[model samples]
Target: MTDRNLRHPSPSPDATTSIAAEAEGFLLAQEHRSAAHREAQTLCDALPWLTTAQAEDLTRYYVAHRLRLSRQLFEASLARAEELRREYEARYLRLRRDLLRRHGAWASVLLACAAGVSGALSTLAR
Candidate 1:
């Protein structure tokens, strides 16, 4: 491999998994946006009697409402994301600690058994 390839850091498996999840979210968002556009067009078509200026005013009002709702949605999504991250981190830490403790106990038992076997062999050699 080239020096550049060796030096370049690869994305973690977890990062790739998260990117796939994020792409799915974006796809869902696009579908929602398309549905909203169709609904707005249907409403405009149904209100044919409204003057152009009136329609413009109505669009403006709805846009403002959409902006407010979007802000609320953004905040909620951010909060949920942070909560999920915290939950995952806690679980990962717990598992890591448990594994370390188990391995340490296993190693200690193996070492004690080996010492006993060696001491017995030494006594026999005498």
Candidate 2:
């Protein structure tokens, strides 16, 4: 018979308690309870041959793996947010510069026109 078909001995009381404690620790550390539950359920579903106790222990490891993935996703999202903020700041600066240049040009034109009008009035008086 294949090794898969052999009946394994049950874990000792000490081992069971250790596993339970580790599993409980993982559950407590998770920020999202629903996510941890979902991960446990998925592990149980995938290993139908496992006893309830064995499944519980395995689920803790699975939950830890899920947490690692979540951390990586959060890091990537934070990087993207920072990149978008910088792009927006640069665009705003460019727009402000363009507006200031236009305002300066208009002010220069108005001043030149005022000077011409004053010169014409002086000549007429003379």
The best candidate in terms of TM-score: 1
Q: Give the TM-score of candidate 2.
A: 0.62
Whole-model Cα lDDT per candidate?
A: 0.82, 0.84
* Candidate 1 residue lDDT tens string, 57-103: 77666655665676689889999999999999999999999999999
The CA lDDT at 45 in model 2 is: 95
Each model's total of backbone clashes = 0, 0
TM-score of each: 0.65, 0.62
User: How many Å off is the CA of 7 in candidate 2?
Assistant: 68
lDDT of 2 by residue, 7-104 (tens): 77678899999999899867755655567768689869988899988888888877777777777876899999999999999999999999999999
Query: Which predicted model would earn the best lDDT?
Result: 2
Where in model 1 is the C-alpha error above 4 Å?
1-39
Compute the lDDT for candidate 1. Answer: 0.82
Model 2 lDDT-worst window of ten = 25-34
